[model samples]
Target: QLERGNLRTSWRKEHGHLRRAPVRASPLWNAKQRSVAAMRARVSRRPHRPSAKPKPAVSPLMLALVCCLCLFPPCLIWLLWRPSLGQRSWFRSPSPLPPPSPLAPLGEGNWTSALFLGDSSFVAAVHAAGHAFDAELVDERRPPLLVTVAEKADSPLLQNFLQSSILKHELRHWLVVALDSGVCEDLPDDVQWMACVSVPAQQEPADTAEPAMARPVNVKAQVLWATVKLGYDSLLVDTDVAFLQNPLPVLADYDRAHQQVRCGSAGAEPFLPHYPWLGAHVAESASTCESVIDLQAQRDEEHGIGAGFMRVKATPGGLLLLSRAMALSLKAPELTLQQSVSQAVGQLRGVITANTLPPATFPSRLVHLARPSRVFAYHQPCPKCVVVHSSWLTGHAAKVWRMKDQMLWSLDGPKKYYSDPKRKYIEYSNPSSMASQEAELNALKAAFMLGAMLDRTVILPEFRCHRCPTADGKGTTPKCSDMVTRCSLGAFGQLDLAKFAGAIPEDLFRERMFRYNPLTPKSAWGGSLFDSPVHLSFDSGKGGIGSLQASPEPGWEIQSSRAPEILSGAEVHPDNVLTPAADGSPTEDEVVAWFGSQTAPVLRFEHLYGLRPQFRHPARASAFDAMWNRATGM
Candidate 1:
């Protein structure tokens, strides 16, 4: 995943109706992985083998050449010697430990108790955990932050879990939560976040036909709530989670200290004594909020525990240290806290733990962060997550299949069909007067496929235009230049970009790995990569939001066209039966708005609907989705 550069899309016409795209295969990520594997597979010592006999004689010419090479140091060095200086093994050395003292943090032979806590799924998961499902409800924010903020529709259940986390009585037992909806206002009491940009006038997607946008939206708050409450030692789980064998034995063992502290064990590894906190314990004082572990790392370095599958050591020492880490990590404004704790530990100087603990130990507590497979659900369960909850309705079946490859059994997938807009839990946005949802989705594809510009060989048969650039200020497709001839893929990405900059999509991302060892730094050319979702929403002027309703904007048209042929409402097996992701894109208009971050698009719609003073215009989910499918081969 190693890479660098700001890659964007640029399309050009080729042939009469087709255009070729350039998209090079990603760098040799596999080869780099093998390189790392070899490093890991280094043997303790070379294997002993029978000695081989030395060769006898060399020709006179060869001897003379060798003599000549020896006489000339530079030639001799080039021909007779290999360079070891810049290669992998000769003289690599780690810096000396200075700040944190070395100490044996954790080891095996420790003990722990187990517990489970979360929402409705908790009952089923607890049954799966081989434990009793029990916990009382308590409100987090007084008056409930949902109503307090402009969004009065926020759900109490989601609010409580997101801010407070599960109350688990089990030691080393984890709690889980799910993120089903969009984030609440990105606001936290502890951390101050400046406005990155004006929250675009809360825009709605094209399909949302209500007089208002849907209410009770808040994923960020839920994540923060679960994260800040981790001292209780619970892992958050998404509802669709499946389990493997009983994790009691593994949880118990995860609490011990590493027995080999002297063998280069450092930082938090010292704290994870094999049995608790991985066998490592914290200083007794770490139990208090006053203790602070300053964590520092490069911005490029990512360290955070996924909200799913967090673990705690059962021992008092392990719990104490974990609590300490949690206390400091909770300071992060976002819900991302785990990696923060790990980073903090890595930052410390090591006079402290340098004297203690080994780097790794046996039988690791494997907490599956994603969904588990089927067999585990049927036979036993693994506490991949200790608590489970979400911002919106958690996907039931997808959770099971998230990691199905490792599972032995499977659940009957959930039933999903062409949705009824009035159906609860299904959400949609409205289209703006300026752009169409279809236009926006296409814009996004234009941006994504921009990567196609890198490789000159691949082309899109759909693009059939060769309009030459014009000098006039007007921006419109040329008339005479109707179609194409052969064009270079590089011409799209590398040609004169200023002219089409506005028509180009700017928001693009690559997976995290592309920034690492495999791809060269120059491989990807976008800006930064994000782990969070970024979308453009349409806003017209409406308020009382509800998922099933339309945007709270007047003069807004959320149009949908009926399919030419009526398709049967039958389930499409594994796919439709399973209910694929609803994490949809911006409304048709937003796609057209891809010109600039803030600029709106220009397009016409027959009518508008939703918002105060509501007027009627047909805007249905099925119709819009149908139109969407036809416009883009989505």
Candidate 2:
């Protein structure tokens, strides 16, 4: 008969949640009943052999000891054999593949790695890149490839990226925060690791102190070296770079060939050779090969690699190249990071197999969004370009504004048309082409619309007399006679009057005016036509009689004279020179006729506003006043 404890245990194993059932109706109970009846029947039918004195009932303790003896050896063997079985190759379950690393996952679809330095300015660039990425892939449903952005520990920019919606939406990933423990302290929770970099102390020249620009290069180099050591194929991107497409696919060819370093060009052309110039045998003794090549001479002949955007594999060779480059940067503090890296690559050409993206492919592949003049000379705008670096226009807001204007003009269908009626429109119907066109148009419209509104409403010029002489009498006093000359009319003739008549948005025109203003603060002005100073002097010998000088500040100086000088080549009116009314006031007809001869009077109006007194020539000024009042209601 089964022990109650054993029965309960067996029942529990089979159906742990169930309560024990009564044994009376069980099969085991029926079998026990039958066996007892059979034993009694056998005793009744046969003469019982004199039963030996009934064995003394086995003591419970003795029974238990016997049970232990039988089970112990097998249990012991099982304990030993089980572990041995686990150790055996055939018996053991396959060890589970290690949990994928969060930092660097290895797979065909694994995240693309990108590194950036600095904060606010770069953060803006990253945001711009994100925008471009969104625009480029709006219709596609593919998962966002992870992009790792690395910044200095305790960088405000890092905090911004962590808290930004850009990362939350899977558009970007904050993979690491690189720090120099000596220079910075405090690590945030969001990043996967704090990359500790040791920056060498700045060794300044005895003749002059170290340049401020050199410090960033040092920090960037050290961070890059540390990243490579950590086993990441890193793409070091400047804060000024924006992405229009995924650049990772472009590196596939190089990655497949096991190339250690792949660099983009600063100009339109690639600097490195097509195939490995040095064989494997030659690279083994790279130091000897370096001595044979004149790197400086090669750099002069070839377009140098752009350091702004470069990809370095995490292999030993890549790490060594980065280390060499970092050391070079520290040694040559005078050179830019790009120059230093170019020199390093040139020096180590034979030691390292590097590839450069072809120059012709640069525009269709990666564009350097530098100054328009610089970029336009080399980069041809197209839909296929993946990256843009706006670093060249960094602090120059005016240049940036002008770039926006150029983009708007490019997008504006009206502006693109030729005089030929046959070629009135360029139609693009392909989805990708349409998407790009729409994106550029949207960006242009978004950038300009707000400015257009403000220009039309808020920034109307207040027509107070800039030429009103102060009580000190130090500056020129405005006179009505100044307006009567043909020289003044000629100056007025040069102005674009339609610009102020709503042909150009007031804000844009104001920006243009402010750019022309010598006294306008560069920080305050949004744009400028002349990047540098332009000297202009009046020639009294010609039809021009006014003496004007640009101040170091934004305002201009016009020499006022009571007796207006008669210019030698001044165009004379056939009817009358002055054409003044009996009341010494210029008639409406005379004012109208004078202004009608002018082409665009916007600049001329500004000039007149600056040169004339507030109450000077009430009748003659009425036309301007009416126009200004009608447009601005001021």
Candidate 3:
């Protein structure tokens, strides 16, 4: 068996070696191999060629040029087609801003009637007087005939019509409306053909009756309702309001829109969606309430309605709105007429749309000429504003009348005051005493600041004075001689240079006229008072060591090229007190004197003109007129 196994293993090994060994080529394979070997021998026998060298590294300039070439085509295309692309259907061009629309013009036929109401006949008369002033300025073709509503027919206040000066100017048709008795008595001269309405008597006091329990019994509301019923569009102006410009033009736009009612607000707050009563409803709908909430917050920041000025069109919707408001007022006596109107309008959302005049056109605060407070100070009368409400100053009739006189003076006096050369100096000079001058200056400053705050374009007298060279050898400068006729302060120290700085250009510092000369100092050149680092170069013509130094106290510094030579005989001129050293350099004493005298004025200028006005602090008198002139573009 061992011999057989060994023979088998040897046979297997022999077979494995045979299998591992290369198989002998077939006749066709041997011929193909011999051909391939002959082809290789033929290729190797041919001449050999060197491989190509690697390409040199690309240059930065060439790379940049290639990159630019790649990017330029698209940029060029965009520039060429930009305008046309904007005009494409998918791309919307930015819309141009709309032009400002002017207020509509008011004509006689615009309103059927103008209703004037007052708690007392005197109050009504005062308002009518103010209205007369405004009426003269209006271009009404046929102004609405004035209608005055009084509490009683025989009220003593209305008895002496001829005796009153205000009534003599404007013809008013009186209507006696007994609110307590629900009796309205129309006068024989009633232009609208208004009839007396008989209202039912109330079991409770007339004031205590509620609209829900009974019909609304408010005379004001009744007057509004009756005006609408008569088929006449009405303008209800409270007695305390002074019409600055005619409001009919503003009302005409609303008339065209078919807007039932329009009201002026006491403040700059917006109306409509921001009504206080709409707050609850806005809170109920969170998803749709964002706009309403934003509007409410904005309006809340502004002032509410001034029911004193209202426009009611002869539309059923407007009448209904007024009626609803009247009913609400009757139910809630605590609420004001304006609040009632707001609440009623809130409830009747889509039924009535009330227009509101912009607050800029109908500012709430009256321009108080006397005792001007900060609240009234910044709220100067806007030239475009239709009315100025003085309801807050009702009890101060004397002050109001004084303000009226001042207004008249302002309107008429400026032309006369500016034209006469003889009066110019006196008018601009200190008025009688320092105290009075100071007061007048303060008043003028306040007026300027207030005008600026209100964004009113203030017209000032032009500065036509001659340009004078300053004492400090600077070029000729424009003198505020016409505006600032006299300085109230004894010395320049008291002058408020900062106030003057605000009105003039920033280069005021370099003007030599305002510079201080130690030997021959003059107050006219007030600019010298500020302490600024001025560069000075000294040329002795001959080379020598010179030094410039600043004093510690007055803080004046001088940089010199050579040491100053003390001349044995230095001539000092009377006008030019400064004596030049032998080396033509100013001595330390001369520099000190020049700088010391100017120190106060410089500091004052820095405090006044160099800085912003501290509105809360009282302004100085000396700087007031000059500053005013600057502000007004004089």
Candidate 1: residue 248 lDDT (0-100): 33
**Using Cα atoms with residue i matched to residue i, what is each candidate's TM-score against the true structure?**
0.23, 0.34, 0.31
- Greater lDDT among 1 and 2 belongs to 2
lDDT of 1 by residue, 507-548 (tens): 222211111111112221232232111111222122112211
Instruction: Name the better of 1 and 3 by TM-score.
Output: 3
Best by TM-score: 2
Candidate 1 has a TM-score of: 0.23
* Model 3 lDDT tens row, 1-634: 6896687678877786655434465799899999999999999999997899777699779999999999988866775566534433243443322211212212212121222212244233322322222222222222232333344422222222211211333333233333334234222233232223233323122344443323222445556554444443445544344555555555443232221112223343333432343323322422321111101100111225456566555455566666676666555766665667667667766554454555555544432321222121122334555554544432332223322322311111223221222110000111121222233334334323422332222222111123432333223355533332322111122223344444543322121211111111223232334433222222222212132122112321222222112111322112222233423243334433443334232221100001122232244433644556663433
Please count the clashing residue pairs in each candidate, in the order shown: 155, 11, 22
lDDT of 2: 0.35
lDDT of 1: 0.26
Instruction: Determine the backbone clash count of candidate 2.
Output: 11
Error of 2 at 487 (Å): 28
